[model samples]
Target: MEATRLEPRTLVNGDMVAIVSPASWPEESVPAWIARQVESWGLHAVIAPHTLDRRGYLAGSDADRAADLNQAIRDPEIRAVIASVGGCGSFRLVPDVDVDALRADPKMLVGYSDITALHQVWNAAGVPTLHGAIAGAHGDHVRRLLMEDADTVVEADRGALSAELTTSGSVEGRLFGGNLEMLARSVGVVDFDVAGGILLLEINRAAGLGMVDRALTQLRYSGALDGVVGVALGSIDQFAGYEDRGWTIVDTLRDHFDALGVPVLGGLPLGHIEDLVTVPLGTAAVLDVDHGRLTVDSPSGD
Candidate 1:
């Protein structure tokens, strides 16, 4: 049986949202800025205690970070939990998250990049999540996704690196995926599966096509991409022009994706670019590759 589609209640004026640093610690100013932004939407913002704590690359000790997240999850007043940033180390806190509580009182988890680890676990718990930045040029759109009742349609970026790689076909499936490296590392670690979903792939600050090659190869050989109906490529920042041994990032992507034989729609303005468009995971979506469009059902609660 298909898992029932579960959504958190949509945000409303006076609702509380938690800002936590479950991954790497964010800059000190980020919590204040994010709080102001959330308040501007008429929603209250609660900054978790360890949002600014830094223990090297991690936000804090795994125990502290998990405590902050668990506190927010168990709080009946908080309706949404958003990450301050995704520098690194969210994966370690996954096993410690209060998944049972979150499943009982469903709330959206929002962030991307390293936060993809949290997204994986939260999504596996049968809750929809937003793959987006907490604060950026795209914050307004992110607000709409959390607070509004409308479908989101993302058109392909004609000039993006993956734009020319689109294959012809259309598919419908639940959206599933995030940062390519995180997805690769998740194999055998996180129980989240990509089978029967439209896989999303994006990259930022990667070390050329070899890293991309190895990640994709790992997922492919591990049988993670087995029943994926289609793929949507987001920004591959700084790698559009990168060439290694005369092979570009696009060359490496095509070699692996071509083997999957699913319709691929590339260059959608999603992921870690300056003008990012937030997207939801674990929600139903229509991938129309021929028309260069992705129509996704709003994950906002009714």
Candidate 2:
């Protein structure tokens, strides 16, 4: 299979970044704090006109959300797009986006959780995106990716690599994955290929071992697990009702993934965890399990 490489564009200081709430709009009380943080980064943060517009659980109407994203992607002045927060409306807006236009004018796109839908769209369109921190997670490790050079590797504490496997080999490929549940939902429809690629996954809320097993089963059934070079499991924030369950998430996953004969590393600081590191979605990265690290290389020269 041919590799799809998306070059990283340089972000100039003082550029305008459009902030859109594709998911549920954050509570109005938090926007000011978020806005101040963005301003401190030396960039003028432009909030989407409908960012605060709410419709029940959604940040705004489907059209409104889609329009904001579209406008941001097409506007050259907006060097990057950062999601305000992730809730539940991004998937609804995906179908209405002009994927072709986004492909033609590739730019930085950042978010996690519900923003996984946009990550899928950008990946399919051959554009790289950031699947790390967003507005709320600005102070997290994701800030390192945003401000540092592409080749920089931000180190996390040993505790960050919670679950450890015994593989030392390295594999490099376009990063493609997000919240496990969201990826599962896009199995049939989204153009995601894990073959020969690093698969990064995370789960939020407390879930039982059975739930994790079921989701992994779906990946296997859909052939999404086939040819995956490495698996990086991010923070499994809250487990729903596993207090009495004998099976730990690590044990359950180890039993399943270890048999697959690939490098598996957990305790990554991504997803719902605080101080999450921003990972470049669709960018080529090298996974070194022995060292308990994932290094993202610049795709500019590829």
Q: Which candidate tops lDDT?
A: 1
State the lDDT of candidate 1 residue by residue for 42-128, as single tens digits.
999999988899899898899999999999999999999999999888889878988899999999888999999888887788888
- Candidate 2 lDDT over 181-279, as tens digits, reads 777777776776667888888787545667677777888788877888887777764653344357666566778777677886666677887677777
Per-candidate Cα lDDT values, in order, are 0.86, 0.73
| CA deviation > 4 Å runs, candidate 1 | 1-4
Can you list the residue pairs that collide in candidate 1?
none
Candidate 2 lDDT for residue 249: 60
Per-candidate clashes come to 0, 6
Look at candidate 2 and give me any clashing residue pairs: 205-238, 206-238, 206-239, 206-240, 207-239, 207-240
